[model samples]
Target: MYAYQCIYLADVYLCEAGKLLVVPMDGSHWFTMRSVVEKLIERGHELVVVMPEVSWQLGQSLNCTVKSYKTSYTLEDIDRAMKDFAGTHWTVRDDNMVSLWMGSGYNFFELVFSHCRSLFNDKKLVEYLKESSFDAVFVEPFDMCGLIVAKYLSLPSVVFTRAVFCHYLREATQCPNPLSYVPLNFVSSSDVMTFKERVWNHITHFQERLFCHHFFKSVLDFASEVFPEPVTLYDLFSHTSIWLIRTDFVFDYPKPVMPNMVYVGGINCHGGKPLSKATKPGSRTQHGYDPLT
Candidate 1:
């Protein structure tokens, strides 16, 4: 009986295996996405990861094909840019919140735009990817490359994300976000709102729309250059077939979720080594060498 079950499972796994194209976000965002990648590889799927040449963790020890594209910025340049952006918050104090965020956010946003331009300009990589004939695109929608690629190739897209920046997920998915009960993350700190809080939420939603128009100007322009028809960031995101939300429902507040959204929280914790007593926080260490050291 056990032998027959093994043979049946093997057949099912063989049938399910497919070629997967991965366009992951650089830095810590890649951490959770890697777990999904590792699982797919174990399931006998062929995986291709596309990334910038100078990314930190994307280059290390992947048993799959990787296509690294050149960028305008070097690793050192990126480091300096990061420090420059982070240092702004430490040095300056502005009373006006709008100006504070706008100044820093816009400057930081320029790097992303530059990277996007660099990717698009690499004619060879774009052409190769178009002809690769992959099954689907698994993307971290933090950067819109994966979303655009999926649409360009007309391949089904799966989004592996924590949250879409600027709370764009609500608009993109056409998911109803009733401000009275459903808290706008940018507008409110708490989910449960008072009458006054609810009223402020509605007012702030309008203000956010106005801000986002200016904030996403580059994205709108980029979309026009990429595709013939007019496309917005929300439109690209709305094309996603599956939304793998990295959030635990037990710890998270009650919120509306769409039919396609799956909360597979703690994905980063998958395949991790068991924490030894010494390695665990606040753990008693008998040996002289402690994990804290």
Candidate 2:
């Protein structure tokens, strides 16, 4: 077994001269940017963050430049899109919640088209990159559009995956796609959700597999149309110069590793900031909330 123990996102805030573009998939995980950009500044690099308008507060707090973009769909929007598409077989509970087949809390078709749209949305992101002239693009895994943009620009790209090795990265590295390799029964997270959440996510995982099989071919076609040389999704991901996994190697199973992929450890390592006595969960009376929140 390949065992990696210390998994933390370092908060050194290195500063380099070259511009680095950082984007996240979710608003809650915005701390990754805080830690990374701080490190970049400390090392002397210019830092910029791209995210949805919802995170404007985080942008203000960091005192960094931010470019807001549409990164997600609301639950209402998802329902509307599903209804618009034909040939989709969906089962919603009486409460209207869907099953999360893979425990990521996405519907099967949602996973597929969500990625497909991300792949297609590179044109917009490419324009931004050209305008900004960023040296590197570090993206959260959920921001698949960043991957597409990075590939288009041929810029050095780094993806921060919250989970262990996922299918896309596995395939890119010429390793067996983890989706195909791992048993369907496997649970990647420590806690399980209610049945309502499971029902929706399970269906989503199934849809994702079907979409990858069906829509990826068209993505290849589009790539050929856009580039002088033909490229596939696998080619795009393979072109990624660095893979930043948010995990340690220890708990993961043994597999053939690649040279470009680096185990950057976890997102929790922010150098050494001693947790205050009041910072503990139940000790609210001491520190009055670390204020980082």
Candidate 3:
């Protein structure tokens, strides 16, 4: 019997035209973004993804038309920076649990904002945006800098949360913050933080907020002088509509939320299909053997 080899390929489908461009920050972006894009495409939307070089490479391989932004520093650089500042110092010894101290130094938050601005103002990107028009833009809040671009284009924007929903941002929106009364990571879950982590989280939260305010102030102040918007950039973030949080209703915590603030927990996995039968089970050889003979 002659053995035959066969290969299978899925049809290439162009994402339907007219949704908007999606600007995802990094590989650590919300995992649900891909699913959301697919659903939008199915509903007749074309997606142009603006991503950093690393994300572009990955997104393009997955068939997305990617806009690449160049960055000088690597993830390792940020990691080292964090370790030196917020992380455990090897110089210290004799501790059951190493306590991290808040140090006074160059504001790491401002440094991070500067890095974000560089990506935002990439010349090629600005030119592209000047020519291209998008219907709307979506971004994760942890990756907040995308909002700058959205604001520049005067386009509507939505924020998706990758971590616990931010109470401060919600309060800024005039919505009741569910986590305001509850401590950070205090939701009813197996993954809730231990006592030490909670304490550290609180400490770090204050430090981060202080620097974040300063960072936002400097950026917004400069942008106010330059941009045509009547409201300050910081003010713009407060009034944004439709904040989608990843917390489930099962968490049993609810606050006086604004109509715009929606609990979109696990909405990322919505409308996704599993791998096809042919893509699983049998090995490639089992499906059809290759005979070199």
Candidate 4:
């Protein structure tokens, strides 16, 4: 395989009017990615977004070719899942590590598996995608279907995400995130941790390592049918060309970065807006940018 360039998810320089295929995750994740899609459109990039018909935030007023596919899930299933997910923030209880560690994880996985299975079942779409001759794929890690598609098409996959789940980032990118200093996500500890916190970090990290395969089992089963060779999420991810993380140093602690990983964090953040009478003073500063004098 030819070496891939480290680039932004949106602004990859290509032949004029380069074609891009997008496989986006639903809900708030789409909100972050939509700005990138619009900017690409503004730059005259032809984009085709393939998404399930039953989605909360997709199918909006974006000027792109949106190809919808049927899924086993319905709108109500999505809403109910979202409702339960959001409802967790308000309903308080004792800290159950098992419950808190995997809040809404199974629900999200179930939906993703359903979509992945249905997407492949639509044999025509799969065949069309193979024939599209697209340049690259933009995908978030939460949805495994996009990765599967990239593998199927032999296209270079660009991952646009905050972080891969369960510390798969380390395995996939070969980037070192030391257990002692780099606190595992979901544990919520900073780079520096107390002895007890460090111990808890190890515990949490170990659990995810053990259970990660279980989380990915359903989708991997679909992958087995599609490919002659055995595959796993790790195999799909190891082929990623660019990793466009949605965080900057302002939002994330300093850590070791790999060559192919780019932090286009706050790339979605808009630039300065003119201050009017309605604009509160220093509001821009509060939002991480200084307002002009």
What Cα-based lDDT does every candidate model obtain? 0.75, 0.55, 0.55, 0.78
lDDT per residue for candidate 2 within 82-178, as digits (tens), equals: 4444223244332222232322233423433354354346567547657887778877654355666567676778776655223456668776533
**For model 1, how big is the CA root-mean-square deviation?**
5.6
RMSD vs true structure, all candidates: 5.6, 10.2, 11.8, 5.6
Q: Give the Å shift of residue 39 in candidate 4.
A: 1.2
Q: Per-residue lDDT of 195-283 in model 4, one digit per residue for the tens?
A: 99888878878887777777777778888888998897788889899999888856776678899988886766779786344356556
Candidate 4 residue spans exceeding 4 A from truth:
1-15, 91-97, 101-105, 276-293
lDDT over C-alpha atoms for residue 234 of model 1: 75
**lDDT of the structure predicted as candidate 1:** 0.75
The count of residue-pair clashes in candidate 2 stands at 47
All candidates: TM-score: 0.82, 0.56, 0.61, 0.83
Q: Best lDDT goes to which candidate?
A: 4
Model 1 misplaced stretches (Cα beyond 4 Å): 1-14, 88-101, 270-293
* lDDT string, candidate 1, 169-241, tens digits: 8877778787888766555346788999899878777777787767777767887788999987777888888
Worst ten-residue run, lDDT, model 1? 1-10
Ranking by lDDT: 4, 1, 2, 3
TM-score preference between candidates 1 and 2, better one: 1
Candidate 3 clashes between residue pairs 3 or more apart in a chain or in different chains: none
Better of 1 and 3 by TM-score: 1
